[model samples]
Target: MASWDVIVIGSGAGGAPVAERLAAAGMNVLVLERGKRFTKAQFEDRDEIEWCRRDRFVPSILTDPHTRRADEAAKAMPTTDGWISSILGGGTIHMSGFFLRARPEDTKLGSRLKEQGTTGHSAVDWAVPFDDIARYYPTVEDEMGVSGIAGGKLAPLAEHPMANRAEATAKKLGLPIERTPRAILTAARPDDDRAACAYRLVCASYGCPNDARGSMLVTYLRRGEKSGKVTVWTEALVTKLEKAGPDRVSGVRVKRLDNGGVEETVTAGVVVLACGAIESARLLLLSGEGFNPGGNVGKNLWFSLYVDVNAWFPKATMPEVMTGSPFIHRSLMVGGALKADEQKTLGLDRAGMLDLLWQHDNPIHRAERLAIEGGGTLWGRALKERIKQHFTEGRSMLCEGFGESIPHAGAYVDLDPATKDQHGLPVARLTYAHHPRDRKVAEHLAKTGLAILKDMGGQNAFVRVGIGETLILQGGTTRFGDEAKDSVTSPAGLVHGLKNLYVTDGGVLPSSMTAPGTLTIVANALRVAAGIVKQAGAARP
Candidate 1:
């Protein structure tokens, strides 16, 4: 059996930072990833079918299926909804890189709900205050080469021609809008070998061929390898965590995907699970009952609620819409705390942010939408004419609103009793139903966004609420808290009953904030690494 001081599973934003920190601290670290390690040359292709339509990033749902339902009463059906990337750097490899920080109020959601007299929700304040994690944000930004102003953290990329007009419109309407910070590099740095952004505009679901986006594969994983103490095993799936005693994880059992059904047991002094929220929770439940003393292993799973509002502008009115620049780069965060009237009318606690961006440029997606709108019968000359009009007549702007989904008793994940994977292991089953207040918050934000688009001279401004959960930003399954009775992990990210088992992913987050959870996950991973290093040093003597 191969042994190491620490074994970190899943080299995403969460695992990579901790692995790099531990290796830099002179501890031998092993990282096991379930996906293949593709080189920069492999990611250079720009095929929409390979990157977006196919199962290159995510697993094939037909084989490794997950079942989902609105509630426990309904029979769960097979779905591909919650799968993020199963690659070397996980979802960060194909992310849009909207690196926004969580507001201070987001850290103390339990206190905010209590103050507002909100009931029947499972929201909890973080074990540590936001300031404890704030100090690590700059480290993440600096290492990832985030491009933005120092104090304001908002620098608009000059590639987008529509930014000036959007800013002017927001200012005229007395709405507060700020430029968003992205993880993509604006200029080539001195020490880094990666190139600057090419403004290709096919960012969200496509891998960056130029390495401009600061994915963990190109950043922390590379740094960890340079430390000479970190070893990464790609295409390795950890199936179970073996226990040393009542409160210690001895090692992990791994299955090699590249090999033909080869399995091995590897020992480690410590184990860290960073396989995002869904898979991390599934692994714990599969390991047995020893790690579930609190019975809180797979509970309180929450996903960010997404509300999309789109508006169309004619080419004659807004000529900038036809400029072919996909960067809008603006966000509306003016609705901070809810006013007295808003609270009374909407029955909500707070408001969320509205991110403005140009509509996706996928031709297939646009054609499908047109086909659906034309009753699925638009073909031949009509379809060609519609496609031309869709491109030349006008362009659509999208305002994506991200709101907090309050964790409730109804939303969670567990092992499916009937559905098993190709390896005969039980698959993860998700039971989710949005809180009623989630729709209200989303609707409020959508209305605000719609008004902004109309103010900007948008012709067909409309709002679409309750577009379901944003699975990529999920969290709270193994939430960390001060007490073991309610949370699966401690404030330092250690599992409740295990001394050496930790979770350094979004699963340890207690609440899903209004913004993306990637930055917070990275910052918290650094904080957890510090705690582990300090503990290791104290035990050395």
Candidate 2:
């Protein structure tokens, strides 16, 4: 058994910053991760079966299952397709590194939406505003080595440049474009011995070969370890958080995965749960009593809005074969996607993004997508001939869009009634469904994306919607509010009743955004860590 000043329950976008901050303050910080850690050498090029399909970043369903259903009345079934990365650096390592921020309108979405009379669930303004959160954006961007373009300042935006292809395409199509702020390194860094991007041109579900992707493993966590005040126990599954005497947290019970079923406990003065949205709430629900009396632990579970479009341009028309959109990935928000009158007809409340990219080169990935397009198996000669013609002759491009999922009454997560993991702990049951407005937003984004593709002179166009395309960008399970009765935590990030317990992960993000919440989660985590430092100082006798 060991003791520390703080115990952090994850090592992803949310947890890494806090752990590093607390450790840099010279506090004894312990981080517990429930997954395997991959070294730099192990991350080779294109092993989709192991990294993408298998339980590399995500856990396998057979051992750790989650039940999913549309609502309470429907029969829940097992689903392992959700994007829950359980590796050392969590989703950060596998993310495409799109570091977009939520706007002021997004922060006040709940109230604005309320005034619009669109109430499907608990949509409200965030306790913290965009300006308040803006203070840490540059710090994170610099530290994470985000590479953006020059000179395109919109409201609540810095002078970031737009990618050439996206900018050019948008101009031709009469669409507004924004530069994608990615956590990918544009140049080699001498400090970390990490090189610049080789432009291998792959981002989705693949680990970086050059460390250009600013994962926590290569950034904050690296800095935190250098402080010598932090310790991380990887592959250590935390089952229950223990309460010693009164109502205070005493220690955490953990099961070691590498060793043969070794169980241990670590005492801590404070506990930070940054284990993503799903597991964070599930862990809280599993905790015994005083720590969770209000039964508000796992409410309001939701996912991000998503749509995908694919088109193939003829080689004869375009002439040269287009490789990939490496540096300049471009995106744009549908301008009037959220006006009250416009939304009344569309049933949507927020803007959506459409990112244009060159078609991927991975054979396995292509095969999988082809299967989906054909609606059946296409093997032997038919598949070979298509591959030959496409690779050597045709050019392809993809336009993917994402909107916010409107949180509703029926969508939530809880402990499964009978299902348990290998550790004998209850698995998380996800009750998720898109609101009517959310579906409308997805439909519009998909249609608009398809229209853009057709305008670009593409053939054999296709689109996909709400088929687990955005399950990875999930949150809203443990949202904070102005009052304790209705929320799980304070605006400052502490649990309602448990003063020392803080949820610094995406779970605490009260509202969903048009983009991925990883960047916001990291920024808010820095805020939470700062508050923790102040409170710790006040307690020092």
Candidate 3:
């Protein structure tokens, strides 16, 4: 077996950057992705009915079962809400491409929680400061070809025509609404392989046909391939990390999806697991009981506490009908520690943000809206009438809100003994109980979301919050902290007590920052890559 200098698992937002940076530094790197690789040609299939309704983009829970329960006493049932892409680029392939940066107050979240007398998980504050992490923001943007404003760190984006409805609404209400920072290209660039946004209506949960969206597949991973030092093996499912000796991961055992369950082992001097928060934690647990002594590997899993408010307006209410754009043109952030002046109204102290989108991107989701509005049946004249009203006279607008899930010890992931995947490995089971504060904040935000729609002259508003809404936004599994006993990884994202093993993913986020999580995930991945490069240099003998 050919041993590599670095082995990075899951070539998505997290792993791709690390692999690319290492490979560019002339390290022999191997990237293992569980899903099949698809170029821009494969992205043309925008089948809303098949892909959205069926489990085409997502894997079946039966094969890769992730059971969920509110608490330890409740029996866990298999849930499809644990939806994430198993494709080569992971969730980035189908992302809406919002790039919201975290604020200073967000970095010191643990202190805020303590000040408020709440019990958050072990590593609530980041080991590194906001400045340390924010330093890499520019690199991530330029490398990925994110278009907005000056195109530098913390810079704003040039406004899009899609923002017309939102801008008009925000202006009418006298609310401060700025252009959203997006990874999708608005202008052509020499460095980028992707074209500008084709204005394709099917952006949400669908791969970009124009390659305009700066997914890691077309951005970082492609850069790694061009470096000629990076080798990617697709459909290679990593089962377990093999430990060589005390505090060292020797190699990884992988099963091939296409080649008739053929299994193989590959050696590496260092292993970086970036299979996302849930799956990465699952794989670490599967490595063996001894791999995680403190039980911090899968603990503290949390999602953005979220809710959506959709309301319709008459066609005459706006200049023209919006053909569905997911760009959240307007946003209002509810910071973790409430400002003294604002505390009187918001009640509890917590972190949250509200986003405004034009309408539902997929027609199938519109049908779902019809069910929620028209009641149970999919086939009826009333359903048709409702759908027609939404498109013509009553065009809809959305105000989506997200609050931070107060990371606690009770919410976690563990291996399910009863359920196993096609590979016969025990699946990841989640025990998630929402923090009382999170539920409270979400309820408050639901009210606030309705207020936003009403401000935009929305009649017949619909608001949804509470359970089953926020499961899609997950984080904080392999969290990093200063103390070895409390956290899984270091501030640099290396696992505690393990020298050659590291994690470069959202799993290392110390706390939940209420925004789109991908921008931070990418920035940290770059920071981790810099650390590895420094390590490799230090060890040069």
Candidate 4:
């Protein structure tokens, strides 16, 4: 049996920073990962099949015999949507490197829901404001070595750096578009000897080949190892959290996933579970004795539904390839919420597809032209001629709607009684729903998407096909709040009843922010680690 000052589980966007900071502070930190350690060399030049289809850079869900059903009607079927990585780096390895900081208004998600005439959602606002985390954002960016132009014209308060090419395009268009802030490193650190981002452009839901994309494996884990204060145990699947006393977590019980034969117990003074939204809540629920007396542990899970628009052009594909997705038009993200009945009546439940032909990198204008011309069908040579004409006309653009999902109490994660991992512990089961306001957000975003394309010169521009929502973007399981009555986590990410326990992950999101959730998750860990360092110094004095 080995004991340490702190034990952090899961090494993705959340756990890595905390472990690195704690180890640097001289605390004996042990990090346990359920997957193999991957390096940058393994991710280079892989095609969509190896990368996206096989999830070579992402984590995988355990396919144990017993899977949980989302509802009673679907009881016989096991869920495949609780998709998470089983690899060492976790979801960060396969994350789309598109990054943005949540806006100030994002902190008041609950208030917005109420204003939209929503009543049944359980989503709550964040305890801290965006300004409080502002300083910490730079720290994470520096640590991860992000690349971009700072304070560009896209979003006024988007103070992070912007991509160079994106900035150029936005400037050329004289549109509200601007370069996006990215997690990938663009320069070298005077303190460390790691490589910078190469701008591979394949950052669409896949790992970066170079160490540039700021994956946790390169930044935090590598730095933690260099400090020699942290010990990493790979292939150790944590099954149970053992409690020493009523308020203290003593250690974790883990088993080897490969053999299912080896069993070990590693004790620690503190336990930080960052396994993710689904697994973290499941573990706490399985820990049994009073983890969530308020029953808010796994209650409020939300996911963003994605709607993407693609375009084609007559010119060479080279120019369009160069721009990459830079401008995030967020003005359409807000509108009065729509009821579920309205959504159903509007026929907004499935994914739809649309095509626009114009000059390469100018789909926005063509989309506007299409909207004006109603629509026309083309065949073979005629289609080729039309594409050439559109290309010369300089009209075309790709617009998408990434909508928010309001948190609901009915959405939750529970331990499956029948299914168990290799350690013989219960498997995690998740249940989520897009509440009325969440659907309305999607509808509004769709309408705004069309408007943006039309404004750009699209004649027959329209929303992408399908119900315009996706269940992949998850958040808010271990929500942070000022009062213990409302959330499982304190503002600092420490569990309410437990002193040494801390969590800094997607699960701790207090509200569904307007930006992609990873940046905030990493930034919050940095803030929490700083607090830990300050507390440790006080204890020494």
Candidate 5:
């Protein structure tokens, strides 16, 4: 068995920041990642089959299945509905990089909902206020080389027909539109080694070949390795947290995936769990007895509610639609925060954001969707003609709404009674169902999206309200707050009753903000690392 000053589990947006900071603070740090690390050459080839259809980044459901059900009374079935990336940098490697921060009101959602007399939901104010985390946002932005105007500027607009038309229509309708911040570098920075964005259009589901996207693997993990105080072990799965006493975690039990079933327990002065919301809760549940004193370890799980609206425009009237466009760096936050009258009519407490962009250029995805729309009968010349019509005749645009999923007692994760993984441990089972208010809010946003597209002279505009979970943006399993009876962690991200154990991932987020959770996760991890470093200094002899 080996020992270190600090051990961080799961090297993604949450874990990597803390690992780099701790190593920089002169602590001997060890990082454990469950997946293999891929080289730049491996990700250079833009193979849709390997990255999308074959599940290269995600584990197969056959060996590591998670059961899901609509409610407690319903029988759970094996599904991949909530599975995120299992690779070294997690979802950040394949994320679209819409790095928007939570609004100030998002931090105090609990009090807001209370004032509005919203019922049947479990919303709570964050123990750590927005100002506490806002100070660290600049550090993350500078280190990650973010590209956008801080106070919202319109200098770098997407050069697409629909994007330009949509902006004009938004102005006509008196809707506020702003440039979206991305973790991608627009130009090479003098301090960083990563290249600038190539604008290849294969960003969301594929890793960046040029290292332009600010993934944890390319930024913090690289810096940590260069610092010489950090050691990272890939294909190392942490199975359990070893406890020294009733209120403290001493180390972790790791299983080597590359080796022949070799398991070892490594000690550390402090242990931080940053293995995402679902996995973090599962790990806590697996380490039984002394943990879960508050009975809230695996409760209050939530996902960002989404609604996708798409529209088409003919190239004859809109010739620029046929031209290739770069990333559509536009977003609308006009109606995100609903008024009291609107909330009353919608039967909801909160609304969400609208992201405007050009449709994905993946031929296979487009063909599949076309085939489905045509009742799966198009083939040969008909398929080719349809493809040509789609590319030459018109272009499509997407307006997606990412809304808050109000927390409730019914939505949660627990150990599956019968399902076990290849390692013979029980898998996590998700029990969830969208609240009635969620549907109302999504429908409201969809209407707004449809109006924008229609005003922009779009034809065949349609909306699809997502009833299932957005697996990539999940949180709140180990919620942090002021009370141990309700929350699993403290404001500083320490487990409520534990001294040395901490959680710095989405698991500590009390509310699912109206935007993507990646930026907030990284910022909070930095704040938690600072606290851990201060404590270590105070205890030094």
Candidate 6:
């Protein structure tokens, strides 16, 4: 059996940074990825249908074998919205290409809502503050070759600290634009020997071939492999965690997906689950041998309910093709309480509160084009008529909001006793239901989005409330806190039960923050790696 100092599962936004930092620090690290690894040159750009289809990013009954339902009564069958990305580089390889630093207010989750009369909400602050992550933010950016300008009104208000190539155009259009901090490298570094950003706009949902976007294959894994301290096993799905003693986790059992039925074992001193939220929680629940007593191992699920609104302009604005907006335009990013009646009117209960916006690329362009071509066949003609009407009198926009799904006693992820994966372990069962708080946020964000679109020159910016389902950005399970009994992890991301076990993914977040968790995840990993190093040094004789 192969053994290592640390074994990190999953290679997503959270896991990559931690693995790189640990490996670079001279620790033997083994990164086990459930999915196959692909380099930048291997990323497919020709299959727009497969790429645009939500199933491409997530398991659509092939790998995962399960689908989500709106509710228990809604056939209790399968459906998907494709929020998560499974890959060697995780979602960063196929991100929206907009890199944003968390604003101060984004960190101060509780305070921001109270100012907007959003009372009775349970938004909690992050375990670590923005100042704690500030230095690491730039460090990760530099390593990732993040291209951005240095100032913005969103996130940190003080002279924003990044720039992007698209900043000038959005500014001239009088839009709330700033220099977008991107995960793409704008220039070359002396040591890395990687290519730089080519200023191509086709980064969203596609990996950059020029080694620009700082995907994990180029950043963390690259550095780790170079150190010869990190061994990454692709398509190695860890099915179970083996326990050597009451206080120790000895190794993990894996099922090699490529061979289809081979199982192997690898031992490690410490195991860090960096799998995405859902997979991490499911893996924990499946590893029943581990030290989880509270059964809170897979509770506190959270996801942002996305809302999209598109307007067809008299002329093609093609906002979606443009790079991400630099400024977050906080006027629309509000969260808080709402009257019951108000929630019902705006379809808030069904869609969740959403942030508003006036631009975004809708992948349904082909369908929209069919309608614009005057194909008066069945609903086709009506679609074309609507397209024509919008072409002359309408515009395209998208408003989306991430509703906070607070931890609940009922909502959790567990091992499905009924279904098993190819490895004979129980598959993940999600017992999630939408919370009223999220619905309120969705409703409020939707209404606010429509208003913003109007203000931005949309005559009739309507609410195309997204399909309201409890999607999984997935974490808050195995949450970190001050006390072990109250949470699974410490503030520094060490598991409360095991001294060496650390969680460097969304699973360890204190609670949901309004900010995009990618940068925060990387920042926290840096902190955790530093702590591990410090602890190791303190242990030396």
Best model per TM-score: 1
For candidate 3, report its TM-score.
0.94
Winner on TM-score (1 vs 2): 1
Candidate 2 lDDT score relative to the true structure: 0.77
Counting clashing residue pairs in each candidate, in order, gives: 0, 2, 2, 45, 0, 28
Cα lDDT computed for each candidate against the true fold: 0.84, 0.77, 0.77, 0.64, 0.84, 0.61
Measured by lDDT, the strongest candidate is 1
Cα lDDT of model 1 by residue, 1-541, tens digit: 8999999999998899999999999899999999889888877877878877889988888988889988988998988777778899988898988788887888888888888777788889998778888789888987987775346343445546677777887788666777777888877754666887788856778778888888998888988987789899999999999999998999999999889769999999989999989999999999996877588887999998788888888888777788755678887763346667777898676878788887788878777666665246787888889888887888878888888888988989999999998888898999999877787788788888888888777877777454567898989999999888889999898999789999999989988888877888999999999999999999997
Residue 445 displacement in candidate 2 (angstroms): 0.7
Of 1 and 4, the candidate ranking higher by lDDT: 1
Q: Weakest 10 consecutive residues, lDDT, candidate 6?
A: 157-166
lDDT of 4: 0.64
Summing lDDT over every window of 10 consecutive residues in candidate 1, give the lowest-scoring window: 149-158
Q: Give the TM-score comparing model 2 with the true structure, all chains together.
A: 0.93
lDDT digits (tens) for residues 1-541 of candidate 2: 7899999999999899999999988799999999887877777657767777677787778888787888888887877845468988889988888888777676776777777687777776788767767789878888888877343221111221224434665677677676677788777787986777766745667878778788988888888888898798999999988877665688789889978869999999989998988898888888867655356777776687778887887778765335333443667773224546656677556657777766666667776666556477777888777777777777667788877777778778888887887778888888887777776777877877887777777778888543344777777788887776667888888777776788988888876777777888899999989999988888889
TM-score of 6: 0.79
* Better lDDT candidate (2, 6): 2
In candidate 3, residue 450 scores what lDDT?
82
Model 6 misplaced regions, further than 4 Å? 54-56, 66-76, 79-83, 103-130, 151-179, 188-196, 199-201, 316-395, 466-472
Off by over 4 Å in 1: 150-156, 339-341, 373-380
- Candidate scoring better on TM-score of 1 and 5: 1
What local lDDT score does residue 9 receive in model 4, on the 0 to 100 scale?
A: 92
**TM-score of each candidate structure, all chains considered together:** 0.96, 0.93, 0.94, 0.78, 0.95, 0.79
Scored against the true structure, residue 24 in model 5 reaches a CA lDDT of: 97
lDDT of 2 at 85: 86
Please list the residue runs of candidate 5 whose C-alpha ends up more than 4 Å from where it truly belongs after superposition: 151-161, 339-344, 347-349, 374-384, 466-468
TM-score of 4: 0.78
Worst 10-residue stretch by lDDT in candidate 4? 350-359
